[model samples]
Target: MVATEVGDKRVDYIPGNSSIRLVDFPLKDASFRSRRLLQLALATIPWAEKSQYLLFPSIYELEPQAIDVLRQELSIPIYTIGPTIPYLSHNQVVSTNHDYINWLDNQPLGSVLYVSQGSFLSVSSEQIDEIANGLRESGVRFLWVMRGESSNWKNICGDKGFVLPWCDQLKVLMHSAIGGFWSHCGWNSTREGLFCGVPFLTFPIMMDQPLNSKYIVEDWKVGWRVEKEVKETVLIRRDEIARLVRRFMDLDDYEVKEMRKRARELQQVCQSSIASGGSSENNMEEFLGHILHGAKP
Candidate 1:
């Protein structure tokens, strides 16, 4: 199917959306098991149609074309009430002072790189080792959120950065010290990164990640890909990783400056969407009104 759609390097089109390409489809190169899972998940689409309303946890401005297409195709009223990642909670003060928050407090503005792969899947041990050594070699300040084996990573990373099992990811992204995000391109992570206005170093692992990476690098133009190719067997060496990290963190570079500008622009858009009289706010109010009245549109 991929071959038929992407024949001879020609541009491939998605089924309904013309602005997005088939090559950027989430299931383009999915494994057999992943494909089966996707097939099973698709069964919910018809089920959704049976309902009176369909609500998407996504910002309408970010995907206007796709949202419009869905509204046209679906019979029920569709609402986009998104940026639903608990970003507003950043305003709530917590009583406890965590070590990571204190660590971020001391760092220079736009100097630290925040690294996190998704919780569902991760890169190989060898790749992790390379990333650890590379970050140390780059001489850049980083705060990495890892799940396991913190002691070993600390030994590899030395004193240049902090590696913890977990942190308040949205809070970390909102920190003034955070310069860029090294991510696995999970949908939630992607949304948070965009909301925070942070440039990205995309290292997608599987599932919808590659497509998210494409949007970050190609469509959004706010990030660069850490791995140039999609081949799992090919390892990105430590030296190359160091070079990329160093360049990505360099604030003086003209290209990096432009990317940062774009990132800030996107952040403004996200903030506006959730504000009063904004697109998301209006949609949410409409949805609430419908529910309260128990009336069909």
Candidate 2:
């Protein structure tokens, strides 16, 4: 979906390149070493042909142009049954002790920011300190989703922000007080953000995150990416983090206003696509019919 320089292959993903990646499925050539896994995948290549079709949780509204390109190139029938979040009953999956909805109630409309890295991908201690301090300095009311307790946050996050081990992210995103998202740009999280019409303050960690960030900032014009220097090592200073956070949180900025407008428009489209008689809903119904009965979709 990113409008980066095109190569001869005419496909977004390069088989061996680390540039296009998912967290767990490290491609054949990545910066990190995993020779054994690569060998195992190579061994399994011949057996992969037995699979019938590739199912994706990607709705057409988000990337109709890209999906059109994919449909023309691929042999298999691809079903875009997505924005799958609404189908999930959070109560059935897990329960939370905290009432974030009440917390959100106290804040002004579109005033707070939500910060989270998904369940996987660990941020270093130093990076955590930087992020916490940056948010603190930004003076923005934020709810940070952290998996475990950390001593560094005790002094850093005062009354300005609330920290939770885990929460129903979709519920939090849907709240009225949420103005922006500081996300790792995981695909699911990306969809949720879009569905809620919240603009992003992207802090991509690894894998598809970079590409997701590219799409958010460049393709969609719904967010800004935090700057980082990558040579022998990746470095993002606390000052830069603070700067980006403050800029994104500034409600008066014209650019930020435009982003919010675009996000809201996209959010409506996404919600409509999953509703009754919507494109994604119809597609999902057809897919199930094809599976459960011998019906053509």
Candidate 3:
């Protein structure tokens, strides 16, 4: 779970640690050579040349300790201010006949489930089938948004599962009918879902997803995670998936009551953060001020 970033090295306009960041993807093998090269390059960038830093850190920094480690590691000024989501909240249930909206209204509240595999992280046909069977067995109506070209979903399912390429995820989450999300635990999606008050059925596919999943079920008290990776097979367990879904979706009145409470708190956070005078809102004002004044920071 403690893996590094993926892909080849790329350049970004940070102040420090900005000297040719090498992306040893999956971080599986940092390749001594690549690491040495990175170190050498970093060494070349004069410390005085570095002044400001901007970074989008993981939501794991929601913990105080994680925040401290980042502060320690990056001596130069850096902003670990993220899980930064674009949020929109409404108290009034306005009706716009977006087809999805009508369908959403008709379904039972806290019943129709949502399944979205992030833009990355595709599975095999077998894996898709396993997911389909698991959802079917769980007896939950769902909307599964699958990505990629060769999912090979012949007879895969959309009867009870309204399969779509993509939808307004935030809108879907806010719908009265949506109960739980079956997700790959992408931080952005996770943030939106949390703000919308939907508990998650988390299946972390890669990178910091496992960490994100941990934050949700363990730290945030928002959702449950399915154990990924297997002893014998590469495929996720159909039964395990079903069990997790059922566990997460078991809407006892008390639990639902608490979840609704959680949702409202999250909504408050988003509302204030985006409103004209709130944290992110104010931060944006200062940011533009700097830009207009010419990157003073």
Candidate 4:
């Protein structure tokens, strides 16, 4: 799938059009955007023009309307064989440190909030400080995966929350204790959260993150956005963060319960999509059959 930022206007690819430009996303430096656009133009233009099929790590169950729209617009077969992480995992067990897993085991189910902004994107130190304080003030049981430069989560949240340099995100999201996620709304994270039935305190930073956030909050009805306006100059206040966290994690709140209900429903849909004879599984088989039979480009 073409991974462009989504917003008020949907970005579309016109087949055979050479003037398609990568849409602008938040927090990118001017020079960086120029270079990235150039790189994408070089890499995707020809590929998009010629590729026979486009495979998205998505399932129609999650976005039937969107998939329907795409099918109508696109000229080629666009397969939705996703929650793709599981198939890609190949059932290879990854070894993880036992300490965090053990800690999660001790906490009550739906008690902990997992916070991570993914590996590549880094926020400003001021924003980081706000997030740390927000987590602390929320008074929620949390596990934050920090980057090497942002190792101060321990100091920020103290012993109230667990701070790790890195851990298996899939493992953490699936843990019984994790009730909510404070995330950048990256597609992988979004899908994982959906798979786990965990609602989000969305803090989208860049690229597809915003689009995924929109889908989570608006389309899916499973999460809430931390900041309405995501800009480099805008810093999310700690109070808003704390408020959103409480709203998402508070099991008693009617809205929170509704979000959880929707998330769990979506989680089941995601699971069923990948199960034997399910939509994604069937699609995968069809995709393979097409390849084996040498479908035309």
Clashing pairs in 4: none
In candidate 2, residue 137 scores what lDDT? 83
* TM-score for candidate 3, residues paired by index: 0.70
Candidate 3 lowest-lDDT run of ten: 16-25
Cα-based TM-score, every candidate: 0.90, 0.80, 0.70, 0.83
Write one digit per residue (lDDT tens) for candidate 3, span 117-220. 78865656688778888887777788777765424442465456676676778778877888888888877888788767787777765555655776677556
Which regions in candidate 3 have their CA more than 4 angstroms from the true location?
1-51, 55-64, 72-76, 80-85, 89-98, 148-158, 228-234, 253-260, 294-296
> What alpha-carbon RMSD in Å does predicted model 3 have with respect to the real structure?
7.9
How many clashes show up in model 3? Answer: 1
TM-score for candidate 4, residues paired by index = 0.83
Error of 2 at 18 (Å): 18
lDDT of each: 0.84, 0.74, 0.63, 0.77
- State residue 154's C-alpha deviation in candidate 4, in Å: 0.7
Candidate 1 residue-wise lDDT, 198-295, digit = tens? 99999987567877887899878999999765442558899999999999999999999999999999999888998999888999999999889986
Tens-place lDDT per residue, model 2, 1-297, is: 121222111334743222422322333125343455456758875643544555568778777766776667566566787788764443533343456767877899899999998887766778888888888888889999887884347568878798878777887887778999989898999999998899998877656676777678867889987754322244567877888888888899999999999999998888888889998888887778788997643
TM-score, candidate 1, is 0.90
lDDT of 2: 0.74
Give the residue spans of candidate 1 off by over 4 A.
1-11, 15-24, 28-33, 88-96
Please report, as a residue range, the 10-residue window in candidate 2 with the lowest summed lDDT: 1-10
